[model samples]
Target: MTTEITARDKLLLYVVGMFAFIFFFVQFMLIPALSASDQAAADLAVAQQAQIAMQDTIALSGTNAAAKTESWAALQQANASYYGLLSSSDLDTLVSNLELGHNLAPLSLEISSINTQSLTGYAASDKAEDTAAPGEIDSSDPTLATADTNAVLMELAPPLTRVYASADYFKACTVTFRCTGSDSDFYTMLDDLAGQYPSVQLRSVQIDHAAYTDASGTTTGTATFTVQLSVILCDKESVAS
Candidate 1:
């Protein structure tokens, strides 16, 4: 006996075929496309980071160039203002200029000393002293130990020493002078001197006053001014050559 196909069987076969096609389409096309998209996003992120780093490096280089230019300009200005080594001829000129044109009491100019200390060694010694401990009292001498007394109070403070450059390259000449006169005249002389030599470095100033009391208890005084200054010295001929 032969069996006949039914409409229900045909419809069932079509539904199963449709489900298999849908499954294969998702596995072969949709899944692979999604994976490719994720990989492309990761690659884009890495490229963006690299670009940002390059931009930062370029900016930093520009900043450093600007700083170097500024430093060079400052060095040139300083060199132009500096005076060279002192000489006998220069000394004579300096004295003549001060005495002839200016009006004040009799003043004298003298060279106090020349300092040629190493900057590195001086700074190291200062650091060592700062880190050292205080010394104990001395039993042998009637007075306190020099170290103990010098450690803090009851000791005179040393003058501030400014280090400009290496001892091998430069020397400092200390010039000191005294000016005595009425207060008005004294200050006017100083102002004029400063105006003439604007680059001179004034180190210290000391003033002394002498007053006399008369029968009526009135007092009159004249002031004396001591001024110390520093002049930088170098071998200008050698440097120029």
Candidate 2:
């Protein structure tokens, strides 16, 4: 048996198929394209807002000769201080040298133990000035507060330059020494070490003294001193790069 479809029916079928295809295309492809276009427009708007904010910041900055000089001087001092740090690679050498040099002391000197903590752990407090307060050893971190030129530029410098610099940009080291030495020899060592390495700061010194009465009825004592030392260190990442 054979059945033939009329041209009118064929035309109707063709029209319906075309409409269904158009609906599916709109649902699957066109909607997603429209949504992506909207997201792109929103992202562009946000970027433009950020750009405008940065331009405003630049516009507000004014140039002054005196301010410029002061800022430049501070910058120079900071850079010098940064370069003065001990290279991380030589940390062992420094410890060994400290121990070896101690043997040359006029009095008995020996290192009993050593302990260290990274300065990166401590928050940078805007504390500094070359002066150590009267027995203020217990009051503050002397290592962080003394002869730290770069730390000032980074952490405590005037607000004018702080935005351009970071308080924690520079890396540093902290170490503690448990040692035995006579009072005179210990103080002498501290003073000399400070002079030799302006970059090194003495954080604290604790001494335990044991007094004994000799047969001559004279008293003698042995002082065990604990000294803490800290110094700037070359930025590990910067060197590796």
Candidate 3:
């Protein structure tokens, strides 16, 4: 036997159907959209981080390039402050100045000896150029012949040795001199020498308080100074070559 439909029952069935439709809409459409939006936001954050890292790397590279340029400029300025190899006339002028340029009296001045020394492996380049084969590099080639000369002399590390050895070599000389002067005058002369010629190195100094007694019976003081100096010379420009 079938039961007859009632208005209240029909109204209840309609209400339940509407509630089920709303639940399915939230679960299938709204929730998935929200989840996809969150995933997109996470991907954008990762992309932004990658972009920031690339910008930082580019900035670091630029800073390094600028630093290298500054270092090169400083090196060039330091090289410019040096006096390269001296000629015969230059030596004569130097000696004259030492003897007469100051208030002190120079009794003797002499260059005892000059010896060849290597600032780098290129020290023997002059000899090599002299005995070079016909097919080998000639003196006209600037690559092997030119010198970026300087007077500062010191032992070099392997990397610097290769750098300097490409062009120049060093030669050193022993300079001995005796002079009669007051203590103040002696020190002044030394200061003058250092300012004018950065290459001159003071090796030793000896002072005698009562070195001489003249006919007037007045005592005089004397000082002896020994110095070593170096000059950078090119293979093709050297006299021996």
Candidate 4:
């Protein structure tokens, strides 16, 4: 038998079915969709940050390139200036100019002997000379016997002087020189030589005469001053080597 449905019962069934549909939609579809949208927004933000970082790196690289170019230009200018000065002047002229500028005089100078000792090997000859009143060799009394002997000795020799002539790289050279002038002149000479000649050094300064007064004739004692100087030759190559 079929029972007739009442209006209230029908209304109650409709309300319950509507509630169940709403709950299923919220739990299974709407919440997951909202969560996926939020994750997408976070990923987009990270991508934007990476792009900004990349742009900053590119800008910094450009700045470094500009700085390097400026430094290169400055170095080129400095090298040009140095070369221009070097090309315009000779060694002797530069030295003389420096001396005059520093109020120094190039006094009497001399280069002493340069020597070198080396080991050399020699061979000995086993032939005896018969000096019988100019009769050098007698009739072969059984052919003369010859023997070879090796020997070594120390040889006192002169070094290559031209090698030391280079002003660029001077080797060891002993400069036995004399300078006679006032105290100021002497000191100025020292300064000038040290500044101009990179290979010149003051080894010893022998005071031949100091400031003394000759009072034999006049009552007022007037002093005559002089300085005797000797310099040694020092070269960059010698020091470096």
lDDT of 4 at 229: 22
List lDDT for all candidates, in order.
0.57, 0.56, 0.57, 0.43
**Overall local distance difference test of candidate 2:** 0.56
lDDT of 3 by residue, 1-241 (tens): 9997899999999999999998999999999999999999999999999999999989899897777567555655555555445565565567657756676676666664444443333423445645322223344554543343432121221233343453243455556666666777778777887787665655557776657789999987666543333333222222110
Q: Write the per-residue lDDT of candidate 2 for residues 22-48, one digit (tens) a residue.
A: 999899999999999999999999999
The reply for model 3, stretches above 4 Å from the true place, is 1-61, 112-172, 194-197, 211-241
Output the TM-score of candidate 4.
Answer: 0.31
Q: For residues 73-139, could you state the per-residue lDDT of candidate 1 as single tens digits? A: 5544554565666675675466446644555555777774555533333234344554211121122
Per-candidate clash tally: 0, 0, 0, 0
lDDT of 4 by residue, 77-109 (tens): 432322111211233344455445644455544
Sort the predicted structures by lDDT, highest score first: 1, 3, 2, 4
- Model 4 weakest 10-residue run by lDDT: 149-158
Regions of model 2 farther than 4 Å from truth: 1-78, 81-89, 102-168, 211-221, 234-241
Ranking by TM-score: 3, 1, 2, 4
- Minimal lDDT window, size 10, model 2: 105-114
Model 4 root-mean-square deviation: 26.5
